[model samples]
Target chain A: MLLVAPAALYVLVFQIVPVVYGLILSFTEYTPLQRGAPTFVGLQNYAALVGDADFRGALWVTARYTLQVLPVTIAIALVLALLANRSFRGVGIFRSALYVPHIVSLTAVSMIWLWMYSQNGLINDILGTFNLSPQHWLNEPSSALNGVSVMRIWKALGSNMVLLLAGLQTIPKNLYEAASIDGAGRWHLFRHVTLPGLRPMLIYVIATDIIYLSQSFAEIFVLTSGGPLRSTTTVNYLIYTEAFEYSNMGSASAMAFVLFAFIAALTLIALRGGRER
Target chain B: MDRNERHTVYPANRRTFLKTSTAVLGSSLLVSACGGPSGGGSGADGDLTVWWPGVNPTEQDFVTEVLIPAFTEKTGRGAQATFIDWPDMSTRLNAGFSSGTGPDVYGHGPAAVADLVQYGRVEPLDDNLDQLDESDRKDLQTGLESGLVDDVHYLYPIASTGRQVAYNAEHFTDAGLDPDTPPTTFVSLREAAEQLAVHKSGKLQRAGIVFSAEAVGMQQAFTSILWAHGGEMFSEDGTSVLFTSDEGVEALTWYASLYQGDAPVDDNLGGTWDGLPPAQSPLATGDTSMTFTDPATLKQIMDAAPELDLRFMDVLAFDEGDEPAAFGGAATGLMINPDSQMQDDAWEFLKLTGSKDYNSMYAQEVGIVPVRASAIDTDYVKASPAMASAVANSEAFRSNPNIPAWTKIRDTLAQYLEQALNGQGTPKEALDAAAAEIEPILAEGR
Candidate 1:
């Protein structure tokens, strides 16, 4: 009990207190720059969120981005992990190369992709070589979020692959060997043995990925600034703009709670679906 | 026996040592708790701290090597200054204030005055300005009018920027246009853009003019063009929105046309120019031949491409004979912290910042035009004829509305403008949409 006291106290002071304070702030008109204490305004801040087109738009954007990024990232990562799992020459090098992007900072990755998406950037240069017109990667409302989604999917691939690979290693060798001895084909063995083995890790990856993808900010901030028409503005990005840019702390806090509720609901559904599986 | 004796003495000595150390530590802690940066809540007495953002090395050198020493010599006080990047300035200011360790003086854009005043974080400068000499007062009056809120001046104008047309003289010559004469009217501007744009197989190889779609505070770029065509974004009383008016619709229509191949620009071609790193500017790479930008940015363009020939003119207007109005004024200013204990010392520094002599030196070193009308005749100002002309003609420059919600308003306007530019909506629809949204915010603010 004594040993846990310090850690518990730290969490209570840092995390729990702030969350409680933020909850209280959500019902008030609070700005750090203001002269006096925050003025409580009941449910006005939360009520305003319901009618804010930008807020609703951001929620929709965040959902679409998550839908696009999560499944694609998991699928590609699983394929990469499967390839890397097979015994081959210099396999360690291949694994390390695959994992390199995971070690790099997200901001650095986003900046590199920003250059690639620029009008005269490498992406356009490649398109030019193929005699195709350069596409506006981030400027069009139709394609902007998809462009960010691609970059995010690439960024998330390595970590997911590594996690899935670890899950593959955990599967009993005898299970696969027995399945093969029973005349199971490669496809049959993978479907029956490998998939069941990887389910727990897959669930973990999907849950974490959803949480992370929903909270995407730096990529949108770096690549598009939530523009060419608010197509890329995530709820998290709008919350940031509200708090830091507009200094509307109360409104930002309200938005944060709404996002929290959203993430919690998704997390519950993910956990339940995993249990059923 | 000697060892036993030594042990006894050691224990006694340890007790004595502990007593003395506790006394010293207690006293030091008390001193530290009571005395922060003297005169400041965090810094020492007689020490002044000034916070400015994104000042170049030369500008910093001038502040450190010239201004601080001169200030100290003049007032018998020491001063320290910290430079923050522009994006981080607001966050830092908020954190500093919340922590109760804010600087004695800080610089912010003119648009921040309403918020600053509303928060009661800045000291009103009416008394300070009243102490100025008559000529100095007159010089500051016209510029300071924008910083005034409800008869109380919250920001002191330190520097000004006016958005004017900048053309690549080399590009003009290459495109068979006059290198010396840039466009002064919308018709000529569009013509020049069409002539200078280079297209290959339906792709824009080189844009004639480009707008910054992702630049920080890009609303100013659009508003400059809007105002140039005699459009008002808000009513005179600021009680209601007016951007849906015919003038506003016309301004946005013309601006949208720039992105539609009606001019040299196309929706898919422009890149983030302003608020990007100096090197990433399209004008620096000679991809775009013309833009509406400030002199400081133009200076940056010169730094990025020293060999490139550049020229500046007033922003294009609707009527050829009408004087072109630029959309910039007093973007940066110094305000004394209302909570500061070192207000007297800070005031001395603020007065120095407002002087012609200091401004001239600052302008020379920083490559920014001085806010002081008296400082317009300096050697640095004389060297840049175009900037000098802009600064001298203060009547031609207009600042954005200084309101608490200006940042939000600007961002909302930028979104709708992009919607129009990207063919998501018509210009009229976009402006009307923005007006619908912003009028409510403005009303709430009122």
Candidate 2:
């Protein structure tokens, strides 16, 4: 028990205390600027959330953003993992190059993406070579979310590929040999052997991706600022604005808890699906 | 091991657990206290700490290299200044206040003053103003008035800001318009914009004029237009939303029309060019012939592209005879933390910043409009046309209501204004929706 005390104390101080305090705050009307203790207004903040149009819109945007980015990112990442898994010359370099985006700070990556999506940016410049018109990637509501999603997919691919690559290495080479002897084709081998083996890592990747993607703030803030009419305002962005911009900490905390509940439910569903498979 | 066997091996008991928990908790608290901001508690005397809102390299250098040294030299006391980016200012300040680590002196826009005042977080500056001589007080009267909340001075304004239409002289001449006389009203401005607009294959090649279309910028642009049309954002008492008035709808209609018509004068919606490096500005890049921008940006553009004859029009009205107005005033200013042991020191620092010499030096170095009216005679203002125009029209500048909930209300309205600009709804509908959302916030603030 004495040996376990340090880790326990760290969690108690850093994690548990903050979560409990946040939970307590969700029931009160608090602004850090105000002197004295937070005023207890139990359930009022949560109740207000139900009728908040902006909050509701943000929830939808968050869900859409997650759903839009996850499957595409996973698919591309898996393909990259498979390619990198092969024993080829410079494969190490290829893997490293692919992982660069993941290691880069999200803010830095977002800044680059912001420029790349601008009217005279690299992406449009390339399109101009094909005699295509310049596109307002981050300006229009129709294309803004997709523009962010593409950057996210690119950013998330590296980390997901690395995880899948690690999972691929753990699979027995004998399984592939046996599948080949059994006359299994490449697709059949992947479906029957590689997939089952990689399911655990895939589950981990998807669950973590959902959590991260659903809470995206920095990119949205730097790129579009949840604009062209709140088309990209995620719940996290709204919660941030509520808490810091407006200093309505109680309502912001309520939004956070609601978001937490959503993330929990989605994660549970992913876990249950993984288990079923 | 089974649960009972494990318990027996550990010999755990309630008393033992309680003692262990207490020790850990006590130590954690001690560590936390030690790790917190140094000299943070109220009445802890030391050198003054200031958090200036803005990370402009020039401003940062001026504060560090010039201002701090001056303060220390004059007072025989040390000072620390932290340059915070504008967007992060409120968040950091909130965190500091909550943690009892707020600086002795901090700067934010006047919009935040009311909220700080409401919470008793800031000290009233009326007494401080009384210490100044009549000439100094009168010189800063306009800026000082802007920082008032319920007739009480809260922030000591360091600079003034105004948004004016910056036009290209060559574009005007090329469009068969006189470069000497600029548009005085929104009506004539739009007409000029139409003539100046360049289109290729039904696409805007060069915008005639660009108003900031991003969320925050849109609100400012709309506020400028609303004020020009003689519309107020709220009633005098600030209890009710007045932006839903017919004049507001008309102002928004004209503003939205710029991006809506077949021959749209502006193309970039939900994108901002306000704070971009001078070379990349729409006017500098020739992407737009005219744009609504502040004095600092305009001056930078002139310096960056001297060959391009850039001129700023005075604040515009809706009609030739009406009072011209623009969304600006008290861009950023300092407030004293009431709990600071160094309130006198903080005020001294603020006085130095607000002094005529420092004010003029700051304007010259930072390219911000000086808060003092006397700065007009300064060589910097006389030499720069943009600075001269801003100073001359200081009375035309208006700002968002200084209410506790103004930021939230502004953002709420900005979202709807964006919707309107993007054709999600008519201007009237957007204003109605915004007014509906804002009314409650306004009432709560009151």
Candidate 3:
């Protein structure tokens, strides 16, 4: 009890208290200026949330992003891990190279992507070789989501691959050897052993990715700024715009709670479906 | 499988106990990081603390060399100034306000005053400012009226910014246009752009002009015209949305057409048209032949590319039939943190910054125009012709309506302008939608 007491207290103060405060704020006209008092309005903020087109649009975008980024990140990571897991010359160098962007600052990575995705930038300059007309990467709404998504995939894939690589190493080589003696092919070995072994780590990685991506603010802040008419506005960016920039902290806090609930629920549902054993 | 993960998990070879201990230490450090003053008393021993944000390296040097030494000599008080990043400054100020240990004075934007006043963090200078000269007081009145909350002043003017057309003299010479007389009106600017605009081997090198999503809300080169064209961005009480007028729609449409054929949106995009460096300032990149930019950026172009030749032009009106008006506002001001230890010293510093001596000093060192009209005619500005014209035009400068919800309205209008520029919505549709978003914010303010 003594050992767990400190860790539990930390969570209770930092994590749970903030979440509870946000929940209370969601039901009130919670101005930061009027710190002591807030006019409670029940679930009016949540009701108001439904009426906000920007919120709805953000929800739609986040939903689409989750579907697109999840499978792609996992697939690419697994493939890279397969190639990486085997002994090869200069494999260590390749391994570090894959993980470089993952360890890079989000601001730095976002700025580099902002430059790459900019018109007259790296992407356009490359496309010029194929006689492709330069597209307005971050500027236009039609292509804005895809532009942001591409950056997200590139940013996220490395970590997912690293996790899968770790999980791949955990699977016993003796199992593969026995399977091979039984005349099992690589696909059969992977299906029987690697799939089951990596399930728990895969569940953790996927849940974390959903939670982080749903609350994505850094890339959106740097690149599109929820713009080209807010084609890139995420729930987290909405919370920022509402709170800090506009000082509508009550509404911002309300939106934050809604987002927290959604992300938590999504993560739970996602993890629940994975291998619990 | 990983040595790095091993290092991360057990820095000193302890397991769960270690990780938990590190987390405990981290939070404890965060506490000490936030707690106040190690230096004993209320700084009554003649220490003046100031909060500043980053700019050019020269600015850091200016604070160290000029402002501090001069201020210390005048007051005989030791001034300690701390520089923070701009974004971090906001959070720091917020924390300071909440904690009651904020700096004596803060270098903040004018836009910050409205909210800061509301939070009761900033003190109104209406009474504290009565001691300054009438001319100085008048300038602060004209300049800081927009930063008022409940009809009381919260900020003193320190610098000014406006949208004036800056032209590349070389582009003008190369395109066979008059290098001295760049366009003053929209039509003339468009014609010049058509002539001067150049695209290269699948790359755009230069453009005639640039437009931004803030064109309608800010309209520095165009705001006065936005007002005169029978379109006001806000109501008189500072409580209602007003820019959905037919005139406002017409204004946006007119601005949009400038980019449609004569200029590509790509040409006018951020940094591309500013002639900035790798980040792409539209003017700096030579993407735009002319730009409606702040004169402050002129120094940037000179430093960035010494060979680059850019000229300044005033904004033209809505039409040849109408009078032209330029948008104008001061950059930021110094304010009294209500929670500051030394109220008398804070007031003294504020007065000194606005005094002719320090005004001229700020102008010379910072290259910003003084708030007072009389300060505009100084011999210093006369030495430079561009400075002379801008100083003279400072009289015609007007501020945004002192509205409570103006910030949110600005965001709404920005999104609307981008929509109108992209043809996603008609100018009318965009204006109506933006007005709709602002209506509630104004209503809530009421």
Query: For this target, which candidate reaches the highest lDDT against the unseen true structure?
Result: 2
Top TM-score prediction, candidate number: 2
Separate DockQ for every predicted complex: 0.19, 0.49, 0.13
At residue A143, what lDDT does model 2 achieve? 92
- Judged by lDDT against the true structure, how good is candidate 3? 0.69
> What digit string (tens of lDDT, one per residue) describes model 1 on residues B1-446?
69888778668666765575456555543442232322223354757888887757887888889989999999898888999888788888876776567889998888778887877778998887888878888886656866877667888887877777788998999889998777778768878888988888776878788766663435776677667777777876677877788877777777778777434364442246332566667787767888767787887777777788887865567666555766777868888888787777788888887677887778777878688776666778887755676677666778787776788888888777777776667888988888888888898887
User: Could you give candidate 2's per-residue lDDT for residues B1-446 as a string of tens digits?
Assistant: 88888767745565686677667666654443333333242455577899999998999999999999999999887888898989899999888887778889999998898898888888998887888899988888778877888888988989998999999999999999998999999989999999999998889989999987876788899888889988898888888888889889988988888999676898888887543467877888898999998998799889999999999998999876778999887887888988788878889999999999998999889887898888889999999999999989888888778887888888889889988887888999999999888888887877
Model 3, residue A137: C-alpha shift (Å):
1.3
lDDT over C-alpha atoms for residue B12 of model 1? 67
TM-scores for all candidates: the values are: 0.89, 0.95, 0.86
Among residues 3 or more apart in sequence or in different chains, the pairs in candidate 2 whose N, CA or C atoms overlap within 3 Å are none
Residue lDDT tens for model 1, A1-277: 3576577557755676567778878988877776456778999999999998889999999999998899999999999999999999998998998898899999899988888887667898999899888787887777889999999998999999999999999999999999999999999988999999999999999999989989999998888888767888999999999999999988999999999999888878988998898
Give the per-residue lDDT of model 2 (tens digit) for A46-98: 99999988889999999999999999999999999999999999999999999
- Ranking of all predicted structures according to lDDT, beginning with the best and ending with the worst: 2, 1, 3
lDDT of 3 by residue, B1-446 (tens): 49878667645545665576557655653443343332111356668887876565666777778777887888888777878776666666755654455788887776566666655667788887676677666765556664666778888777765556677888889878888877766656667777876777644556667655432333342345575465677777777667777777777776666555444523544222221142266566565677666666654564566567766676465566666556665666788776566778777877777777777777777666556666656886765444555666664556665555556766767777666766666878977887777788778766
